[model samples]
Target chain A: MRFKNVFSIIGPPMVGPSSSHTAGAVRIGRVARQLLGTIPNKAAIKLYGSFAETYQGHGTDLALAAGLLDYDTDDARIRHSLEDAWSSGMEISFSLGVGHVPHPNTARVALWAGERYAEIVGASIGGGNIMIHEMNGFDVQCTGEFPTLVLLHGDFPGVLSGITHVLSEDGVNIGYMDVDRKARNGEAMTVIEADTKITAATQLKIQQLPHMIKSSIIDLTLRS
Target chain B: MKYRFLHELAAAGQQQAKTISQIMLEEEIAESGQTEEHIFGQMADYYQIMKDAVNKGLTTNTQSKSGLTGGDAQRVQAFSANHEPSSGEPASTAMAYALAVSEVNASMGRIIATPTAGSCGIIPGVFVSAQERFGWSDEHMVRGLFCAGAIGYVIANNSFISGAEGGCQAEVGSAIGMAAGAMVELRGGTVDQAVHAVGLALKNSLGLICDPVGGLVEIPCIVRNGFGAVTALAAADMALAGVRSIIPSDEVINVMLEVGSAMPSKHRETAQGGLAQTPTGRKIMENLKKRK
Candidate 1:
């Protein structure tokens, strides 16, 4: 069955091992890392739902650790990734959350880097697919596939159109895009799913946009 | 040309070969780009991977045999001895190959969710048997796998291979088709026959459940791979020999998708149906779940 939003991009990719456990777990970790925005000085990952129950055997633990450390699925280092995460000063933990969701595989990883804190909640669809459902209490949907541009732009009219114009000028087609508002006159988050490569110039221009709050280009085209 | 099916099959074979080589290269098992020589080299690589896996398996078997003999020289000597004469051997036949596959799964293979660890045996069971009687080769066998991989790539691309969505059909059925098609290719059959063999393999196990006992890839899944391999070879051989199915390969794939959709959640590898229904199955699952 076809899925819209984050679920669509999450379904297919060339990844190592199983998709649901390995790929999904890695995506969740990657999201957590992105939310942290730096190599974590220290972090604690709590896996829930299916991830908590079968994390060890399914290699979900290693996957999360690898993502936090910025390792891709095909990284040969994944085999000994836990030690790597620990050596890099990342703290990890696991617990089953007391809740139910549509998908059995879900997780929450709370991260910290010297007081810079962020929370990432995500789900693993079957075959190693992952959807980042919520981030930092905001209902944000992002599939950890494709090269994504996430910008916290001004909560104002014409911001969306301007973003599209930039992409058009760059010859990048939009595969998917979504926006969420945190307030009436504060900041807004625009998650653009792109088919073409995001150049450095485009990233710099998006950051320099008037009233732009924060921006990051997340490139996920590297084979897992 | 009223030979639309034939032309399509030939085209499909070439396309299949290209895709399989691509995946192999992407997986870092082979290099990028190709000529006829490169394609053949990739085929050789595939052959060696299959052959080496089996060879590595022999080490464990030898160790186990040695342990059983407990260093008794006479016992070890007797065990190592080959007594049967080539003349006294039963007539080399396809049926013999098929039976041998069953024996391999039952006695040798560590099943990977209804797929034989020894991937080649299943396809060879039918392919080799038919080829012996009809004359085929290693090249045909490799090409069949390439085609099968193409079909598998599509399913894997479009659906799932974790036995979580689609079941054994996605794994063993794909393998069988590849094996059978290779057989057909070697025997000078048209590409339609190869694709049909894939369809035939998929059809035989459309809704075959993935009920690995205790969540281990052993027991019934192992034996099932043997059966799956033989079935694929047989399907490809029949298609090659000019036998046409009322249902086409594409239709069978659609059916597989439908059946997968209709299946109860319990049957989809939750360890809750078929063999998993028994008291013994429940106990095994419980024991596994209890482990950290």
Candidate 2:
């Protein structure tokens, strides 16, 4: 693997009850907010398997709430997330789902900001590391350990080429890309994972393209 | 049945009596200290002395602010009652909050950083319980500690302690297992029973998330240590009573591994899931960032 063993402790020490439940949840929530392109007006998250069974004990509920509100992992406000959520009038619920093949601590977060909507599914790999498994029914993957780009563009022959071209022109290097199809003629999802920065101008240009539904840039630089 | 339990338990307790200090020494081998063998020998000696202290009933039960007390009981009641820790009482209602400040400092000073600083309370909790309950010879308790060390080694090798990798299963889960196994040995349980106890304690908290608000390990992390300590004792007690788990230790370890792999990154320690996403959570982060 290009990354270190998922369990290796490479850097400074961490604060934890468990890295996945607390830190990973916080980052996932933050990523979900990024994918929604704004703080979620409301979010409904369902945790499958172990996450649902032990969410409260492990602080998963609080971490998810913190993530939706756009809190970073180290944000002290995370302690008060439940109270904040209750006061904010956000609807949050947890459910156990049947996803055996995916990671053990899988979670699906659906975010709504007025008219805008997005969903993300991700997993904690280990050692405060995470893998964003999918976004909006697309087979997307990113470590959330680096600065990443989650772009939703129209399905076209030249879409990938256009994205890479613009990125290359802007001095951004492509790390990885995944594409998922909803239909032959309907809207499709494209997730581009990159090692470089995705500027505001690039995001705007990409969204302006025909067939583009939404565009989001998620930065996971400090989260990993 | 009574004889069988006592025999099995005593045999298990004696299995690793001399090895606990050996393991602690080995854990510190790579650090900047004396030679590896020297450190190992020193740890072994310390283990023996500590064990002897227990045998002599010389434990200092100093009632350090970090010791488990009434607060632990209240937290257990709250968890069983499925009530959240009262966030309303920040500094006043609970004495442990004041103690938490000192506990963090003591952990930084006395205990070796095994996985995390926030989880420092577990080992001490185990030692204190052993001192109070059995008052066993230092050798016996030291062996018990060694047995716990073996369990920790297995967990470290098979899984991870990073919340990001496997959520809290790797951190608190593993810690609970270690404490339970250690307690089993001290209490004269067989190694198999020790393993079973460790597994049960771990399974109880499997998939627990590591969501520290604002990424600090203070809030839930501090309190969870007390719980892990008590649970470890409970697990050891169950094992001593011949309450075997349907699943073997190996199988339970496997389950933990699989469950951890399946956890989402957000659910780890990224502060992205659970409480990190709430409006108040966001505001807290924003406020902290602003302060920074």
Candidate 3:
């Protein structure tokens, strides 16, 4: 049941040398890009455990760069993503180690656009599958396995209800919900996994709620 | 979800009173909510991709970015064209296709990861070569793919499919088993025989490590794909010939899980042991670093 379709068993239709290191790395990078809502001018990638030991041979470095630049898993341009990033003036750097993360394949992808910054901690488990453990210091569980809507807001009573109310009003069936926060009345993240795409209008409506700072919709269901 | 066992596939076949392909088809339909025709079209598309990868690699002399893998597929095919290969046409063709796909992958080309990219070579190598050898229909090939996929599904759920998780045994080894099972089904063997083919294939691959020279999927990785394909054919033939595995497929899979867990981290695709530690392997790693 974890792998629901034949496609999961057969493919990802990817550019390859290795799936866990290449395609999975690209996906982690892509998810980070989508989370930032825009491509970052600067990115610092940190590979952990097995990823640290063999990033170059598997094109994990290039693949992650391609992903942060918004390239898909099957994009041929991935072979030259490093050169492309340099030409685009998108600053990128890589290092090894994500401090005690249990998974063998983990990446802490940090993206920045001047003052706007987001840190994504994710693990590319296997079979091109990934699990996002934390984002921007909030412990949220959102895998790009489904169409997900992630919202950043202040930790308060009305934030969660307001966001869900907006989504429920649109008749969006929430498959799962995770409300992760730092402390009481501090910053927070509400991650909602939905069956269908959440439109821009819906995102704007949710963002307009009090304490809602930002929102981004990650749709893995398209060519998903 | 309950179909995470090998016996479950046989049970699924028995419950529906159908072949392994039909059982897999029913499971796929129930899960994805797509029609049989739609699923078939998608599988056909994947087959096309696999075929295209082989075609592309066979035509090109381009080496991978690592410069370690290339030109071998063409060389193998040319050598087989004139010389009488000891393994005969089918094995040679399968090996050629296997190397072709691996070459394509090493060069960063688009290819289907039957279970994973590292092991992509084995399935296309065995299946398409068999089709060319025996004139298997597109529909028949599709059925074979489902049979392969069912075995992969069980292996993936029970253990893992990536080299990083369970070494090359999990990647190439699983692909070998998958191709064997698929071959049995395509050759009209019983479901029990298909499962037995899986066991017979994997039982030989128990301790294979994921030791790529310089951490690249070139050195032993590309070469292993060819042998893996042949092993699949051999396993399929054995099962079709009524050879039985002493251990069942279910127990064999559990052994894979245990061995993977017991395997040291360095041997599991970290490029720290086996061939990766050899003099040339270290040199290649250094050269790659300098180039970067």
Q: Over the stretch B52-155, how does candidate 3's per-residue lDDT look in tens digits? A: 99999889874998777798889899999999988998899899999999999989999998788889999999988999888889889988888898898889
The digit string of per-residue lDDT tens for model 2 on B237-258 reads: 8888988877766567778879
Q: How much of the true contact map at the interface does candidate 3 reproduce, as a fraction?
A: 0.71
User: Which portion of correct inter-chain contacts appears in model 2?
Assistant: 0.08
TM-score of model number 1: 0.66
| Worst 10 contiguous positions by lDDT, candidate 3 chain B | B25-34
**What lDDT is reached at residue B197 by model 3?**
96
Point out the higher-scoring one by DockQ: 1 or 3.
3
Candidate scoring better on lDDT of 1 and 3? 3
The TM-score values for the models, in the order shown, are 0.66, 0.49, 0.93
Go through the candidates in order and give each one's DockQ. Answer: 0.12, 0.05, 0.65
Deviation of model 3 at B192, angstroms: 2.1
Q: Best-fitting candidate, measured by lDDT?
A: 3
Runs off by more than 4 Å, candidate 2: A2-15, A99-101, A222-224, B1-292
**How do the residues A39-84 of candidate 3 rate in per-residue lDDT, one tens digit apiece?**
7999998899889998888889998998888887788899899999
Candidate 2, A132-181: lDDT as tens digits: 88888787777765457776666677777777777887887676777777
